[model samples]
Target chain A: MERSIRSYSPKDTHKIGRRIGTKAQSGDVLLLVGDLGAGKTTLTQGILWGLGGTEYARSPTFVLVNEYPARLTLYHMDLYRLNSIEEIEDLGLDDYLYGNDLCVVEWADKAPGYFPVNHAVVQLEVIDDQTRRVTVSSETAHLDRLVMAIAGGADE
Target chain B: MSDQDIALAIDTSTRYAVVGVSRDGQSIAELSWRSDRNHSVELVPAIQRTLAQAHVSIEDITVIHIAIGPGAFSALRVGMSTAMAMATGRDIPIITIGTLEIEVHPYLDLGQDVTAIIGAGRTRLYIGTFKREDSLSNGHVYLEDRDKFLENLPVDSIFCGEAVAELRSELIGRLGPDYKIVSAPPPTRSASVMAEIGHAKLKSGDTTDLADIEPIYLRSSQVASAARRWPNTKTE
Candidate 1:
């Protein structure tokens, strides 16, 4: 299932992320695909907030991954610096992606084929300086409730 | 005792980077710590520290033993290459033991089939089935989905390893009271166990050829071949 919503401001985007995060389960993976400044980190911050994380979530670009404790542990990964599939593979991603945690990957399009089959892809497209279109899609029903939650929240 | 009596064991196959120094099958010193993903940076210094603590010079170490893995890809490489390089530099024999074998070693006395598991990310596991009589063999480790593996487990099968804690509820729920699950102590504390296994292999002449030994990465071919593409690239 898939859902798309338009965010007229960064705050709106964060709210959408929070909605998704609240419904996330352990072992859930959210792949964020967007250009620079497309609010990936902002959305992640909102997701972290939704998951009951108090510390601010930052871009783990140089560090590659940053772990935040929440209702379910959040493993936030940034692949902007990794240029190839091998670089991503060396991240030992299986543990986070497969373990009992919620993993959110930034720049996930860097290796489209590298992630597991069951994951939700969150794509963001900038419409203007302050507007963006966020699309969440997944083939498996693993993320159906999350998609529904986001869709339901967007209507409010 | 001759130089051949000192053994160094390295296992960076999981979150823990473990180093142990043993002399004549007895442990002299050992260190194990959660390394996150810093194995490449942490392993050499760990080796130095363990050797220093044991009062054994690196040059006096005659054998190197490594846990080749069905584990973290880069972590396993860090341990394997360090062991290989040290062995090559010293012109000593290097013995490679399967990580699962080391994991299953402490449970072989139960006289039951033991299934040792290492988490393979995403509710999948790298599992090794060891018949009590032939616990030393390395031919049985394979990857399987965790739920399926538990559902099909034989009655009275004993399970152990780092992944056991996470699977305890599931194992008990699915298999009911017919199965047994033994949680091993934290892996870092088991470096001495790895050293003992290495020592036994050393005494039995089960050393690996320096030129042919490679890390045992039991991933699917797609991921395996992709990893092979950048074999020379440093992970960190």
Candidate 2:
């Protein structure tokens, strides 16, 4: 249900991303939590790249959500500016999360109420400017193993 | 033209701005504000928030549909400018909606004839008629000058817009109950309505170039605001 990870640098963070990307599914919802510049965006880039061979998987904060049409459509969402829970429904967001696309949400904690129930929650805790601890939460056994593998493989 | 696109609707045409409305025709997701001209600050965040809220992102938004005018020059400029800018940068096709029509829609009736107008100046007006496009679909709007509008007025045209009440006596005395006046909501220029109209046009291969799709300024604006000209703002 819940697993944890640690990363020493950007490359270590990306290893966490690669495992998630390799294991992501069409209806999977990945909720990333971290403070400002905790390498959440860096992890996202790795996940998006691994999932769909995409080269661009930025924060998508100012631009809202960015979609890449590759092997599987990857939806990247940054919720740093969200106001109300209705803001989620207004944009028709769940359509993608429930559809045939992989969803990654940043600052998902800001809204607190809108995250789907079965989503994988990634919590990044900064130990120093260069070191970070990441935790994953999910119910599916497959994903639990994937998270374990990635967290174990990460040589932070 | 032969594709099902990710239709986008941005409505920053008022004090209350809408970054990107849903493909659905029901409730709208609006970016509300008071006195600040904060579209620059609110727009992208609103878009991102709305997109994340819906669980989709900008990439899911294939067709950039936006409101053009019948609103504040700045707010109106926001949706169009942002849409055009995105279309240009992303190489996506753009869909333009009539700002006045969206505003006047809540007041329109299929059973009764209707005339939609945003104010021009003096007695002259920026008038457009909503002739029945179909039984199920909303009517069409011919955004043009008053004389042309008056000439094409559908039988029993009920007038409602910014200055319709101002011309109420003249219009009523002239057209009677057949052409009455009504009030409309400010966020009326919905991307949903535009999607309906634009769909027909788009299906018939009637789309304009992304660069050519500009605002539909019903008339050369007077010193008054869109609320005065159209109902894109609150009623005075």
Candidate 3:
């Protein structure tokens, strides 16, 4: 995927998230990487909204994943709950990863696998109390267009 | 484009059958059920029964009218999707109608800006516009989360729909004459109406491909929709 970076405030993350969700179709996997409080879940919230999810999308920290069946079921997963790769399989990550629905995995780095390269990875950084810097990555060119669209284009 | 053809319309936006038959934009048979039960089990059977009652078969159906919801998300999905799949197999066209549009139909004493809304879990509403003259808007818009409703109403808006019964007084007190409270039929999919809309669009050459068709879920469940709710970022 083509690499792109964009800077946004935590508040702006949701709008970016919404854009992704709106365009997200069934069978799309989004891997999100960011430090704590970096707005990963906030962006995911926007994604859920874009994907036509009705229920609120929250951090799945306690639960590894929360499945919301909507126009397209949104599987919100937080890998932070998993201790290791061995535990990922038990959660049926693969079932949803390639399923006929959209999936967003927060803190995906904690699980470690093809997830890093096979899908779009949005890296968000907390630059200051009110600022966030994002670097979006992916191996597929399709994702580059998605990232560019989500990050708000050209300069971003 | 067949005359006197049968059509299957399904409305799962709320807890009702809102199903029926139509021939060239005319209602032949219409059936609805009132229960807070799962529409999943009931929608299909109701459709089949309606067809049987009308003495129509799948082959007789020229179109499928599915109520696209501003109601329960899951219910609308079930109804729309079921009809969508069936229509695809039969090679028929699928038409989508909004829940609020059905609610604010020609029967109500609505104002020009009638807010035909459906409850969106967590006190939010899905809205459709209407004219006091007894006709509804072409489509519906979401009120998003309720916390934002009062903050961003479309102005001169009157509230209607299943959500009105509970939230009426509060909304009226807040918005005033802008909020004309009116009794509306519980939201249901009107297959017959869908036929009218579909037939009109088809005649005007306004239909979309099945694969291109999707539910009009107002917000994205994806990160993108989240952006709409997120505080818009100020560019420096």
Candidate 4:
């Protein structure tokens, strides 16, 4: 399933992220794909906060991944500098990838082979300086509801 | 100690740049530091300090032992090239050991089957299993893939090595309360253990040809340059 939503400002983006986070459950792998500074980190922060996390979510570019404890555990990973399947495998990612946590991966293209079939992907494109067009697609049916919630909730 | 009994060993795999010197099967000196991407700068100096501390000169060294990797690519290259260069025309033998085995050796006699794993960086691992010999000699080692490694694990097995810290919870959860998990010592300690192994190999005349040595990389590198989009700049 696929849903395309537009956000004219950072607030709009955060609202969309919050809605998805609110609906997120265990064993959800969320792939966020976008260019640099396309609000990936901001959306992640919004999602984490919306999930009732006390600490702020930061881009895990240098550390590779960061874990957050909320109503659901969030595993946030950034793969910008990772270019190889070997590099990704050596990271011991399978220990978390298969676990019952909410995983959000940035630059999910770096290790495209590892993402499971039931995951959702959000492609955020910079339509203008402040506007972004996010296309949410997933093979799992529940993620369609997530996309719907994000699209509909943001307008309210 | 005789000059011929001095063995110098270096391991740059993983994040540690470690050097060890042993004489007559006994560890004499060791030095290591977290290289954190500074392998070339830190390794030679660390080796120099370790040899000096051991009261042995480079010219007196009879064997060069290296932990040829299933490790970081650049670090493994640095260690192999350095060891080869140090042994060139010096009549010194160079012996190589797998990095995973180095991590697995210390726990062989714990009376349990052992699973040693090192990170291979994707969602994969370079894993090996060992069963101690009846004479208390080191176990036979076999490298296995992560999924298969997990599937075929023996009951009451002990999981150890460089990658275990990240998987401690998962392994315990999977194997239940009966299994044991322990972290191996840092690279400096493992390099010393490797030196002892190399010394044994030296006494037994088990060694590698200096020219034929290579790192024990089970997986090939995955890097490739992007395809060209423009036509050739030079015309025929």
Candidate maximizing DockQ: 1
- For model 2, chain A alone compared with the true chain A gives a TM-score of 0.90
Clashing pairs in 1: A98-B122
Predicted complexes: DockQ each: 0.21, 0.01, 0.03, 0.05
Error of 1 at A140 (Å): 6.8
Model 3 CA lDDT for position B69: 64
Q: Which regions of candidate 4 fall more than 4 Å away from where they truly are?
A: A1-156, B1-3, B134-152, B183-189, B220-236
lDDT of 3 by residue, B116-234 (tens): 66765433457676655643444446545454665666576556677777766677778776555765545434556566765665566565677776666553233233333333221
Worst ten in a row by lDDT for model 4 chain A: A109-118
lDDT of 4 by residue, B190-213 (tens): 567887788878778879888788
Instruction: Encode model 1's per-residue lDDT on A72-105: one tens digit a residue.
Output: 9999999878877656766777767877789999
Displacement of the residue A30 alpha carbon in candidate 2, Å: 60
DockQ of 1: 0.21
Please give the lDDT score for candidate 2. Answer: 0.63
Model 1 / residue B212 / CA error / Å: 4.3
CA deviation > 4 Å runs, candidate 3: A1-156, B34-37, B105-111, B130-140, B151-154, B177-179, B188-192, B220-236
TM-scores for the candidates: 0.70, 0.42, 0.54, 0.57
Model 1, position B119: C-alpha lDDT score: 77
Q: Model-by-model lDDT, in order?
A: 0.82, 0.63, 0.67, 0.75
Name the better of 2 and 4 by lDDT.
4
> Please, what are the lDDT tens digits per residue for candidate 1 over residues B1-236?
46457889999998877899988778899999999679989999999999999999988998988898888777888899888889988898998888988888878888888888777777678888888777477348887777678778755668888888877888888878775888555562377787788888888888889888977655654455554554333221
